[model samples]
Target: MFKTQPYPHQQMAFDLFKDKSYFALFTDMGTGKTKMLLDIAAYKYNKKEIDCMVILAPKQVVPNWTFIEIEKHLGIPHTVAQFRNPMKVKEKEQIFNLYLSKKDIGLRILTMNIDAARCKDGFKCLSNFLAKFRCFLVIDESTSIKNPSASVTKNLLKLSRKAWTKAISTGYPAPQSCLDYYSQMEFLREGLSGFKSFFFYKCFYAITKKIRVKQQTREDEDKPKGFGREVTIVTGFKNQDKLTDLLDSFALRIKKEECLELPEKIDIPQIIELTTEQKKVYVEVAKRCMSELAEDQEITVTSAITKIMKLHQVACGHVKLDNGDWIDLPNNRLETLKNIVEELPDEKIIIWAHYKKDIENIHKMLGESSVTFYGDTVDTQASLAAFHNDPKIRYIIINPKSGMSGLTLVESSLNIYYSYSYNLEHWLQSRDRTHRIGQKNNVRYILFYCKGTVEEKILSALREKKQLSDEILNNITNYVKEGMKV
Candidate 1:
């Protein structure tokens, strides 16, 4: 028997997954959810309890699982397979056969982006496989299943029925509403059982609409048909400790603050002040946008603002210029990032960007000394190999969507989010890439945002959403109504 030493939190998580058929690991960002999950898979495989495991995540992250997590965390030797988009029936048949031969393999891990699971055939096949072999289905960044209306979310509910055990992992579960808990809890089969009866369960925490009033024109009246009543889950840090003891039977969660003996972090935004020339151009562009708006023409002010930010971003030297393309700017984030990493000891650092452009810039700045994983790549095996084998490679610039979950980059405890995206789920998962398992040192995560711009506003809104601040949401509503063009 290949025995593996478990981190305190990993052991706790493994224990929880042992008995619970449906559960959640609401561990914070930088917690070791990925390693905990693999440990659980190993245990189940050893016990012959499950022949396979399916990890469903965002598209940006699916590749990382195949290339990184399975290799890094599953201490015991295990053969893993990947499911690529089947362009032909022949490929589908091959995947089908691989899925059917699950029992023979000690632990078969199939990773797919949540989008793949939403397709009718994909859902049906997954459902069939689960029914045939008792499996463990772990949803990394489980909030993707938060919405009931989304096709993927619906498919997850349907596909999850086949799993002998179901687990959801997320850092910030309700980044929007306590109602976010409803679908997640439902996924766990906690109280509500399933989605069809969710409305009935909702009645327990929501109030019904009783009246409606029209605007002064008496033409349109917007009235709430149902409003949520305050419903709080009494689980806190204390209960979490108790829950851990119980989870020892099946699941584990590790917080970076509690377990990792990492370094003190200094997270500072290296603001790239716009050059005078760029500022002049930006102001002119903004003026043009406003002029277009005045003429009742559709203008993506959001995109326009993004352009201004890009211009400032260029001033920082992060932008690239190609032949016959628009003026190529440079990425300042890379320079600041290089300085930050140079300050650290010889250990490697993980750099996350929301765009491929940033990845290109980071690549150009770092040169052959660095490696990256993004959308436009073949030979996935080669990319992973380069990263794993090269000891001197100091930085790995990754697209957050592509590198966040199911990847183990724990060699370095320092992670920097160069830019942010509105997708709370991706941001949460990206931080954990370096914070999860094998990290003996404490980890520091830095989020860089340009102050006073729409970027900052979005970040503020997201943070407030996590707190479920109705006042903040109301203010945002007013701000959007006033400034947003329909």
Candidate 2:
């Protein structure tokens, strides 16, 4: 009773863990983890195992479950309720009550942002629903609850107790380190890692070192005294073989390269020469940052990042001054983008920018021929639909922060990075928006950076970080294989 045919990997994942009480799907982005979850839900519902399924996802990804994936994949009748507006308490309560009171035979589905589940009222509504109906609880992009001390993680752990089945899904589960798996696994099932507490789990897996830091204190005139304090920090991770074995027992990990015969990803770097005025501003910003560093005895990472961010902004053709006003500098980045668009006149292109100014400027430059999917867009779904369905819409200007996760932009095989963030997740997820399943052509990622600026440095750093992350992932995969042999 499936609407769309499932990929072999998706079917394999569902078949393996559909009946399990708890599992993790460590599938890569664009590998259709959402559809697999729905298939499992449908299988269990038809068997009278679960009366309802509740999906908790990011604020941006919540709607896709109700509007796209479920409608496209689930063949059985289902009543869907999505909690989009967390502020509408009365409306949400009425909808919840209506669903709870219904004597219908169809499967019940509710999707809500993970952020909402952390709140008092939102949690109350969900708790009430769970209390009334049998639920298969799933957390999409489960990394949101990676921090064990977070209130939302604690609340979700409590809520997980009520579910008949539980699952957590993410392309990159351990984005930073293996330590991220602690709270996420705990949410799936407490003591799943064999360790009773996070502290013990950390001690077992992490190699930590003690370091002394000078603690700042206000003594004489609001700031002066600095006393030394010792702190323990994670130097590296150990016992990966054991950790991989533990996770492999209950998790299915799939990478796009291994399962899909999809098109190759081509990286094209387009360097833009900054205008005279832009170069002047960039140099001035760099000098100021250096001066600030010289003046400050101890510069925090936050302040240092802020200083470097100014240099990035300058390279992007605009800089925010100390007075909270933006000064537009001269740059050829937009002109270069326009020329690239001209060259790809017949093809659809996705333009990604980190700054709001860049998005606005590109939108203005492209005009009606392009649609924007970002924070200021009134209807992101409509924008996405137009880009997907309309032939006239050849360009889609997007902010990676807003349009990065859970989006399928297969209509565009060409992705141009007008500006990018330092976030590796943003870069990876945004690139996959087009490169994922159903994309026919070889996906080309073109990055535009000003020559000899912080933009170049940022891109370099992202590549190095990605390489490190890939190495770690490969090591884990090898360890998992070795453990399987035993």
Candidate 3:
């Protein structure tokens, strides 16, 4: 067998793009798109068609490309370097030196953080590397460059001409409107969208309206001389069919269900390791969680579940300290989630958490590519609209109860429960949100649970369709002994 064999659909994708110099992979996430790209890069490299390959991805996923994906999928040996902004001066010098050295490297491969391209140093490093070799530049999650005026997009567009071949990949091609396609497609090739500039492109697709809102800032209120800025809102789109037809020329559209045989639902459990401090706190919580089982202690559904909820909170890395203060213990939950995200294929994903803090942390950890749907999410409707329409939004962090009633997230094929809810209805409703109508592929649900913690019990109860309060009544006293075995 090959080092990493491609599925039949993946092999077909590889063959279609292998010979093309500039083509877009519109394949949905989790369909082995990355491997297909790597396979094609390997094939062309062996034919001496390219001297180097540059893979640009988000900063959070840089380690994944350098360590995991490259090794598993590509059979060839490559000297990989990172062109990111956060690296120390010394580190950049070392990587730059290696890129220039005359080593017996089959291909001078580099996986750079796309956000770094905004800086002058990051842009120059990759541009200089591109100048030295006949390189193929591949942009994964290409919607990152949808904004025409973003610094990174400008820097990348300037360097796009240096590459011998260019490709952009994304499951969502037009997340907001057809107007977003101009900037992304412009990177694939000059005039690929048959437009000279973004303004011209926007004019062709969007009905634009610039409205100036009244302002009362300190200066404006005091002097009454300054005017508010005029912001242009896309009133609506025009001639979408024309734009879609244009995209069909270079877009390779692939949906997961059309190509792969998959079950209706796949459930996977993510094991989380607690930090030393977390373990210490967890032990304390566990002791109190079942104290009701003692000879003199009284147990009730209300009291037992409340204690269990606190234990669940501790497992999520935060807890309420006495004296009405909140104490956040050292926890690895967020770190574990980041690791899981790195392993997933580049695709839109839904993340459900029971706590608001978990939702916020998850939103922050994933950076600008994520949106949270909860009570305090400002302008909840607008945020939900973006979650529904924005291609750049790859992760949606949702509070099950808040998102359960009437929302559809079928754009994503994977759903992850960062933590569980005791409410059976919320849990089941969240699971169905991504698997309903408009969903073309099977949905995979990955639930993260801390073994030997309250989460395990909740997950067990939900899985067995047992009331958590009843489940606790049966084993609350023997939780330490009968339950919580790793």
Pick out the ten consecutive residues of candidate 1 with the lowest summed lDDT. 229-238
Candidate 3: worst-modelled 10 consecutive residues by lDDT: 292-301
RMSD values, in order shown: 7.9, 7.3, 16.8
Each prediction's TM-score versus the true structure: 0.68, 0.89, 0.58
Across 1-486, the per-residue lDDT of candidate 2 in tens digits comes to 667898899889978987888899999899999889988999899899999889999877877887888999998988887875544787567465546665774888888889887888778867977888889999999999999889899899899889888999999888778999999888888788788889999999999877554444444234444435656877678999999999999899999999999999998999988788876666666666666555444444345456656777878899897798887888888889988899878998999999999999999999999999888999888888898899999899999878878788897798999998766778877888988889999999998887666567678767666533333322322322222221
Q: Mind giving the per-residue lDDT tens digits that candidate 1 earns over 1-486?
A: 215466676676667665556667778665666767777777777777777788887766576677766786786655565565553777566556667663555576777767778776667667776777778888888878888778887777766766887888877776655456667666666444333565654454444433222222323224342322332331222233432354343324446778766555445445544444544444454454345434322223243344334433433334434452445443345566777766875767677776666677777888777778777755544565677678767777777676655566666777777766555656666766665445676667766654434445555654444432333232433332222221
lDDT of 3 by residue, 92-179 (tens): 7767665778877777788887887887777878888889888999888787798999988988988998899888886665544577
What value of lDDT does candidate 2 attain over all alpha carbons?
A: 0.81
In model 3, which residue pairs have backbone atoms overlapping below 3 Å?
A: 175-389
Arranged by TM-score with the best first, the candidates are: 2, 1, 3
lDDT of 3 at 327: 74
Q: Which ten residues in a row have the lowest lDDT in candidate 2?
A: 477-486
lDDT of 1 at 302: 44
* Regions of candidate 2 where Cα sits further than 4 Å from its true position: 86-94, 210-232, 295-301, 464-486
lDDT of each: 0.60, 0.81, 0.76
